[model samples]
Target: MSVSDTIVRWRYRAVPDHLLGEILTKNWIDNAIPLLFLAAVVVAFGSVIPDFYSASNVAILLRQWGEFSLLVLGLTIVMVAGGIDLSVGSTFALGNIVALALLNVAGWPLPAVIVATLAAGAAVGLVNGLLVGYLRLRAFLTTLVTLIIVRAVVDMLLLKYSVKIAGAFVDSDAWYFLGEGSILGIPFSVVVAIVVAVTLHLVLSRTRLGWHVLAVGGSRRSAHNVGIPVRRVICATYVVSGTLAALAGLLFASRLGGAGADTGLGLEIAALTAAVVGGNSLGGGRGSAAKAIIGSVTVLLMVNSLVRLGVPSGANSLLLGLVLLAAVAIDVRWLKNRHKVLSKVYVSPTYAALPAAPPTDGDSPYAVNDRLRSVELIGLGDIDGPEDVILDADDNLYAGNRTGDIVRFLAPDYTEHEVYAHVGGRPLGMAIARDGSLLCCIGGMGLYRVAQDRSIEKLTDETNRSWFSVVDDSRLKLADDLDITADGRIFFSEATVRYEMHEWPVDCLESRGNGRIICFDPAAGTTRTVLRNLVFPNGICMAHDGQSFMFAETWACRVSRYYYDGPKKGTVEPVIPDLPGYPDNINRASDGTYWLAIVGMRTPSLDLALGMPGFRKRMARRIAPDEWLYANINTGCIVRFDESGRIIETLWDLGGENHPMITSMREHKGYLYIGGITNNRIGRLKLNDADPSWTGPKSYWGRT
Candidate 1:
């Protein structure tokens, strides 16, 4: 067999992309892997050493894990916040020493001793926080220094005082009960560890503080720009880490009945190893307290099993090192390849045969014209991917660009342009509200409004997620286009639910029904889904009568109409069933007709490939993005249609030299404002026969 054939055969046997995505994205998967590994360890050890599952041994295991779990919990938080606390072991040792000294030597009250020990640990964390957060020191280096200093101080104290908790204190029932006592068959220490883990888990997953921690860790610069108080978040993580480590030290001292210089030796490595193995990323922003507990248990189990199997204590270090290295490598690889893996699952559509060529005769109804060829170029090389353009009542032109800016050009000459507002997502379609606020559909961010003073307010960003979705679909994935109704309701289209805005082409390959139509009422301050499960819904525009709206589903190559009032209220039907190319934005023409922008011409090869689902899936996995057969978006045309969806006139940029991938067009006065996704300049086509003062905003809201 050929190499290509062999590769295909191999891929067929591999895990499918959709299944892999489902498995990887599941929350239970993280804990499940460790749990399975732990089970395997238990079974293997139990077979060789019969007493492995004995009640006494299990109790011993829980006791050991309890103290170790405290350190792991703190480290997990630090790691999740995109920082580390290497001084945890030292802090742990210090807590034990301080507690013992205060309790035995100074004869202090138990509560006071516990308080002082925790305070001492917090002091160390405070120093680390100041250096790393306020001073902007590297977490690794700063924590390493703190670890050394703390460890040195611990050693000096041990040498100078030779301090140890008295045996009499250990004999006290009150003190001994804390470490060895049992409540309803669960050890007190184990109970404490369980409470701490559960509490931290809730905090990390549910609380605002947890969200900020994750946000800061996910992208520190992004967090700072969004006003998350990056320094404070980082600082707080260190303090929590230090305090938890001290608590763990106190537990260790109480259990062992004394404090020693080597009490927490090598404990830092164990804590870090557990956290990493628990599926927490060392790079930050993704870990949990449950993961830490599981990791700690796994490590403890491995060590215990090794001891029972006649393995030397020295081999434990080597085994831990290997495991840590493997876990880190696997996690990094999974994260890096997640997108590529997801892309592979998209099964391309296939046709029974090649699609027929579209006729483009000059004599035909869909003719080629030079209406845009000699147009004036505005914002050339300054605007990036201005998908749609609109004009306000005062004749100011507004266009949403790929760089997340809504640019405005002062009219008459249209020479001066400025950024009206920055929405931080690729802004696709735009419209002017009756009050003159600019409403825009920002891809991946949802709908937003920019007021007269350039201040942006988010109108809506959520929708009712489908039950079939594996990820949270409530957040708008791609808010493609929108239009306002006469009754002050805003109608919009979400391009796709499965993929993000950047992966638009990928969703096209899948041809899945992942798009939806939504409506927002400004009066009620509520947003709701108007329609669901559309095929890449792109552009939206209100009907001339204001009782209905028209939307274009780009992948399906069709335009549909939905009526909320009149005879066809709450009904949907196709306006144009099949098109010559992929449709983008549809806007009102000066003469009451509508103009639609065809972004790209349909091709036979893409249609044929889309028909064969198996072949398309295999191709997606084997080929690179540039090599994949895609919808022909390199050349485009603008076609005018009446209320009945019959084509009247067509304007083409055949060579795509002047205007390629035309996405939007608006008729204003005697000129047509054209926007292209791939063009640097906005095209202006002059219409000699059209009215001179009829702008787009006036045409919609009309001199009110």
Candidate 2:
């Protein structure tokens, strides 16, 4: 080992002891997952329908996204700061009604018009905020009362004071400029909304206001203990929320050529849906503006596209209901289940042509919580063809890429440096051997060993498949996962023998039972199948006692255990089952827990496919021997499970720039490491609340 690396490891130990959960929640892998998922939705639709991206369509989409994002932004701030405003839609309606009443009856100028509108909105926000913050009322109950009263009052005022508001403020050039005009080729409203997005981003990310908001949301008692002036921040968020709602109202009125009783009608549903879909945590302390916008765009796109696609008028409400239901599900569920399975994505321009397999370590348990959240994604940009990840004795990481070599990085930072070893083929998983050498698993090319001096030697090109009863198939079907046992046996799984990794789900749908769990004792150097008749086994991890290990069965969405000793020996038991996403790998977390990685999610499309066995059988029969169909696994993400198989937390990528797909996760020391087979580089993140202090891949096991 290099003297510099040794010194750095010593320094990490010298630092203060950090909390495991604190580190786990740090989102160490990549942050841009949500946006990418939204983008993928956009791209998928745009590609499928020509009118989806036309100029007129784009304009409408931007306008709709901007307006809904404004409302969602308002709500997310309150939500992340630990509060909810059920009266947002009513407040929004009242903003327009009040402004229209003033402009029509009193002939108020543009300035007064806006002030009056905001003032009215703020008044409602004040009542709601005071009742909840100072009077200690339940937020939902208080806001519900306010929502009823405000909606009624707004309706009454709109009816009682109806005048031609166009001349005064609604139809004036000034109002039009603010509502629909452009600045630098970008719509003025879009620019305004984006500016608000950037400002909120800064406030939530860098300022004391952001910290206090988080404190207030995380715990009211802790916020009080920290002297955070929780009530003030709470009130401020609502007031800001009201102001923005009024701004949206004003724009809504102008864009529609004046307001009416229906102004901002049903906005609460759309706005709240956007906030939740954007990945905001209703429990607070973890929402981002980026997510709000992405969620808003996604909502608007689906709604608008369905309308444009000539969906039956009767079905429109039903479809909208589904998306809304999904958004609400994403938000409310994440509130209680942030630590559960997370789904996300990766997108990069350079990776446009790469074919990706869901990141799997051939037996690692992968979780599949497809529910969206309100957190910002972190992305790992350009790098080489990266594949696998490994951790040293001290929990530092070493990984591999398509360049036929293994590399090293410091966890937390995950900054890449000099190549550690040069193998002769495409390395996927790197494991530390008992002899102090590194074992490398190469896709399509068998296994090999790299000495301390970086010299490489072949380990085994063939694993026995005699049990399969297939003739003339003498090559190791596929070497996908890796683990070291106390007895020096290498335990791994062949993802599929019937098809290569890319066409795995076909085997999944076929339920072919072709996967096998194999082991190779270094002393004898012969690989043998310990368990056959499995379907797409992915990750491999030994139990702490060293007598048994667990592996992921991807096709069936379960984890199976193989005992190397004891009376239960040679028998397999279901460790975890019915995962929401495709199971990728299972790793031993240093915290005495097991972290499972779920590669893709249970999309409705796949659900349909699963329900129809004949359709799959027929498709397989028609396809050419070498042909493959890409499913939506690219839109899913990763997660972690405990030793008892109880879901603990989720780490997701929404499926784009941050990470298109996360197939593997290895936790080591204080950070987490990530890998995707088709990705050009691996990713690293610090888990703010993760428990494992050390002894992991930094737990980035799949490096691929």
Task: Report the number of the highest-TM-score candidate.
Answer: 1
Worst 10 residues of 1 by lDDT: 346-355
| TM-score of structure candidate 2 | 0.45
At residue 291, candidate 2 shows an lDDT of 76
In order, what is each prediction's RMSD in angstroms? 5.9, 23.3
lDDT of 1 at 280: 87
lDDT, candidate 1, 84-149, per-residue tens: 889999999988888777777778878887888899998999999999998999989999899999
Per-residue lDDT of 234 in model 1: 90
Clashes of 2: 83
Q: What's the distance in Å from true for residue 582, model 1?
A: 1.1
